[model samples]
Target: MENAEPFHDTRGFFDKIGSRIGSQAPAVAHHINPTDALLLLQNYEESEQGWFWSTDAAGNLTYITEAIASVLGGGSRALLGKSMVSLFHKTAEGDAGSRTLPFILTKKMKFNSLEVKAAASQDECWLSISGRPHHDRSGNFLGFRGSGIDVTAQRRLSLDTARLAMFDSLTGLANRASMAKKLETTLTAYRQQKRTCAVMLVDLDRFKQINDTLGHPAGDALLKQVAERLLKVVGQGGEVCRLGGDEFQIMLPDCDDRGILGDLASKIIGSLSQPYSVEGNRCIIGASVGMAISPFDGLTSEDLVKSADLALYEAKGNGRGRFRFYSKDMQQSAEDRRLLEEDLRDAIAQGALELAYQPIVNAKSNIVEGFEALVRWNHPERGHISPGLFIPIAEDANLIWELGEWAIRQACADAAKWPGKARVAVNVSPIQFANDLFPGVIDAALGASGLASERLELEITEGVFMAETNETNAMFQALKGRNVRLALDDFGTGYSSLSYLQTAPFDKIKIDQSFVRGATEPGSRNGAIITAIVALAEALGMDTTAEGIETLDEFELIRNLQVSHVQGFVYSKAVSQQVLLENLEDGQWKIEPSGPAHHRNDRLSMYRKVRMIHENHVYSIVIRNLSVTGALIDGLYDVPVGTKFVIDFGEGQLALATVTRSNGSLQGIQFETRLVSDGNGGLCTSRRVSPYLIAEAGLDVPNLPAGYVPTTKIERDSLSLPAFSTVADWTPTKARPK
Candidate 1:
């Protein structure tokens, strides 16, 4: 009995351990004594699968398994008196269960399967620890008794799986699903704070061609490069994510200004569109961006995403290298575009499409040398549809081949009847040029029309260079073998490569209209660019044509630049075949150049209804023409010069203007603040009325228009009489003048 004191003194510790597993140990103790149970506990501690731990009333460790102490390189006595919480801390990798270990011990509560890692280990080692409060028979508080198993391998597996789920494996950017969840959560929090957020959807143009040509590994490498470039441009301003393949998404918090968004979008487009060298192969691609802002565009992630997608579709439809912000009117335009595509499919069959030829005259003599055949679609309902609108649609709908073949045949046939040896140039889409059957189509057209091969010119663009050099050269040889003239069109618009000029057998280089439009302006580098282009053409034994010379200044600049040919409205609009023949009835077809005497800012003529406000009165007016600096409007009678008015261009755009000139039912007003580009070849105000203000004004935030009346109380006695009278019976002209 005296020697039994050793067994009796440790009886409580053994009992607590026994109760944790079940009553099995106590039942075995009824048959044997405490000595045998202690022996069994010692054997269990020697096995290192799991280690047992007990803390004193103050959370200091009283006992630790011998195996762990030795493995830790500090024997049992060195670690014995340390705090249990200090020995293993919560894992910094955000293990959820381990986060509560300290609090659980402070409150003296039971906890199970908590995760932690050793604080002093050289290599990371994680543990899954379970503990409960140990108490006396009267239920007074004692300390914690716990057991832990090494969970380092399992933790590594879990973290790896989580990373794969949340990030793109190839680009290492956030994946689509992770972005969606983040957007939703962000929107939810921002709604409570009444803050703004923006989203941009970017779709890469011509990525498929590169993918198909260069192989999948190259494509993957290109995507990684794109991601890196995006991060550099966006920096910490936004979260950039790859939404699989060629699509990416950027989320910017606390931003609502379209000007800033547009600039960022343009930078992204310009950066991504630059040539990329992947695996030593040069590749070019473009990007289109669609943007949406929260609380104005949508209140939820799904709705905002849809708006951005629609804007992206519009940007791609108009032109690939551009960006568009979400607008209320885009919903209708999208539907109309779909219907237009269907109508375009039937246009060739129904004979609704025709070619109109604009003269390409010699710059020195103003003598017509040839005509560039532009395809025109006269929709029965929509009147004349611009090629700028329909050409890309045809390309997307796969109708370009059929339409292109028809155009080549029609253009040759029309030129066969000309009185002189004037040539006809037909545009060649890259898609058509890539086809093996294109040469035969041209041969058939020339044969059927009896037009000379020397008089038929095919105008190709730099986009054709996307193909292999061997294939492109082969196509050029086949066309040249037929004595067909090759003109490289839109030479400086995109991906301009000297390599293309050196390889392709081009007889002419046409300066893009964009260069010519601004070449005469002061501080413009476009003139230098054109001079270089003209010099390059001359050095290569090729001719140059300047396109879209709409002013006398531009005409003179082209002549001074020694560009060989000029084509634009400065001479005349595109004429019908009948008109062309009538003009050709007289010999040589020499025409005098005439247009506006001086260069002016580009003005877009259209009929758009808008609200004009003077003092407290509002009147409806029609804008006949619009420009960045001013507009000519109708439906206001005899407005005096210097009279100020507020013009409302709907969807929250407002501008202050003063009348500079007036006539019966018409006035030309200059804007106090110049309008900025809307990025769709249009002008818009740089700022808009805030949706928050609209809500505060007691108006429906979503449906509010521009130029709302002030909510602040106004003294009626201080109001002035209206400056101008509305023209109630005023009728617009039947149509826009050509």
Candidate 2:
């Protein structure tokens, strides 16, 4: 041991190793034996691993190991006494550098491994490290001591496994499983925070068609392009996942407002509408999207997904290429409709339906000219449900023919009690007309009621004749041959034209009430339309009835248009058969014309009173056969001289005249300056006054035969009262008898 040079060199090497270890060791381990630490370091360097050491208060290398550097490279000597920075090559400064070392020291991390270039050879090396804070048994902190190993190959293998599990190889998007997990986590957080979010389920509208027509590879390429576009649209806050072939799902975590989802859906539709070049061929594809929101459409992930799927179905049903939101009412209505459809099939068998008649009246006469048979249902449990609710159900169930036949028979039976003049207007459903037995059903109904076929009017909408084929035309002709009047109900509502009226052979066109109700407004479109319709019908030799004429003004308007008939609530609502019969028997069946002829012989009739004074011979007479235009003064006797007379007309109208001569029992007088007033301050126009002149000599006043009627009849019979000239030869003279 005395002054051995090899021993000194060995001690120097050990001391240098200790100094390097001292620099890196945590302070809490400094008090450990240096020899023991050296042994530990030697053992670590010999093994295929790495370790770091630190000093204690005695300035000894309390912790030492060199296994990590040996594993990272080839030898521990390359790492011994090298600063922690030296493990990194110059080219890999970002992986291991002063910046990272400071972070490790300040964090007091036990260890960390990073890939870096070796300072000695400038070659890349992978290192794995672990570190823990050095502390005494009492937990007094000193410094950090750690160990590390290089595991770059192991890391690469793990990364490959993760990529295979979470991503789609073709689209490079998160797979369904990963997306589901992410959605579940996000939904949980959203539920806890009471926040809103939206999930969009997107299904390509015609991906299968593309795959069929083009090729599967082309379809796959299109899907990849679609994924890229979706991601571009969704941006960072949202996640897009490929659920399966041609189906993608998007989860927008913080999207509380559904309007954003709508916007996104629109974008998706627009983007998909553009042609995509796939495998050198341009391909067009469409997409349908369904969106479900948190706490509105659903409360959980499953509920949301299910609701979205249902909405997607709805979108597809609505011709696809659109988006729909999940609505509880929609689902409920669909379910209700299904149940009602099933019940409707049985309802017909159970006779739950009935028909009631509402009177369609003549506007002028206020008489029920026809009955509009409206169907009603007396549901066993629901009691008196409207036909609007159940008739649609029957139609959907394909039970319309049965229901329509029943309604026809019931209406016919009810109409028989009404006046024979009154028509029974049975509404024919469009669905019933699709069957070949429609005409036969009408025949059966008329036969059952024993009612005259002429009294039955079949009412159908204008749409019935639209797109009419030869078969439909033949059916109509057969019905018409049985004396049934065909009325196009709700005319002017749908595709109404003069050509239809001419071609359909309709007996009448019922103008819809929308026009009739507004008819009173002068210069209104309704007035013009109604007038045109009436004119058209007249031109076609068809009767036109205005429906929904509820007001007196509307009645007047329709009457002015000369519409044949009108019906509305103004007359009465639908009633039972007994009520209708009673109403008919109550003598309310008078047909009043729409004019002033209702009161006969009540117009003003006038007769003239005449008086004559001839040289102290006073004569009194009366005029007969007075009309609005002229009169005749008859009962007068002969007078010896010319006399002035005044004649009084009713309503304070009078005239003055002079008797030029007389016959045996009559005298003729000339109207002298026709009086302007009738002595009662009422102005008399010339049209109400007439004049006469004497045309014969005097008659014997004393020897006049009693009660002798005039033999010669003048056009103006009043002129024969005396010797009067006809108004045709009479002329006005400017003179007053003095």
Q: Estimate each model's TM-score.
A: 0.85, 0.39
TM-score of 2: 0.39
Q: How far is candidate 1 from the true structure (C-alpha RMSD, Å)?
A: 5.8
Per-residue error for 208 in candidate 2, Å, reads 25
Q: Indicate the worst ten consecutive residues by lDDT in candidate 2.
A: 688-697
Worst 10 residues of 1 by lDDT: 1-10
- Residue-level error in angstroms, candidate 1, position 400: 0.8
Q: How close is candidate 1 to the true structure, as a TM-score?
A: 0.85
Best by TM-score: 1
Global lDDT of model 2: 0.63
lDDT of each: 0.84, 0.63
